[model samples]
Target: MVTAIIMLSVEKKHINQVAEKLASIKGLSEVYSVSGPYDIAAIARVQNNDEISELVTQHLAQIDYILKTETMLAFKAYSKDDLEGMFSVGA
Candidate 1:
């Protein structure tokens, strides 16, 4: 599986509404409203890198209040107990 962290910049007044809409998207794993260079952040999981790219371009980038997005593809994970048993490590 592939995972992405999408950082979103949205219009101030639409923050909550946009977050709610993003949460409803099928592949979205989580959403948060934050204060920073961006207004919201969302986590999504898909079977491939191409799938996540397509989803962001075909859907997320088109959401009404979203101004911009920066996506980070998650390559490795460690130290988080909640995710400790979630994936197998290989060398």
Candidate 2:
């Protein structure tokens, strides 16, 4: 799986609407309203890099309320599930 971290800048008064729309998109794993230079942050998992391009260019960018976005591709993932399995006490 290819993982991507997307930072979004939404238009004024449209953060919730933009977040809700992003949450419904396929391959979007998580979306959070955040504070800082960006208004929202999201995680996406897709089958390949091409899918990432399509998701960003075709889907995410088409959303009317989203003003800008910055995408970061993940090289490795370390999840709580993986950590627990690696350090399991038994079996």
Candidate 3:
């Protein structure tokens, strides 16, 4: 799976409504209201890069209240369970 982290700045009055809309999108895994330069954080897991492109430029662009977005592609995720699993392969 391809994972993308999308940070969004939305119109203040529409923050809640925009978050709800993001949660309903098919490839989006989670939506959060956050504190920072961005108003919302969205995690999307999809089959490939093409879907990520379409999701941002097509689906997300269609939302009326989103002011700006920054998308970052994840290279790897580190976790204790995953690390342990990798080292325990022969045990």
For lDDT, the strongest prediction is 3
> Which segments of candidate 2 are over 4 A away from where they belong?
83-91
* RMSD (CA, Å), each prediction: 4.2, 5.2, 5.6
lDDT of 2 by residue, 1-91 (tens): 6889999999969999999999999878799999999999999877799999999999997899888999999997777577334433443
Quick one: best TM-score, which candidate?
Answer: 3
Model with the higher lDDT, candidate 1 or 2: 2
Give the TM-scores of the predictions, in the order they appear: 0.85, 0.86, 0.87
Superposed by TM-score, candidate 1 places the C-alpha of residue 3 at a distance from the truth, in angstroms, of: 1.0
For candidate 1, give the lDDT of residue 55: 82
**lDDT of every predicted structure (CA atoms):** 0.86, 0.88, 0.92
lDDT of 2: 0.88
Candidate with the larger lDDT of 1 and 3? 3
Query: How many collisions per candidate?
Result: 0, 0, 0
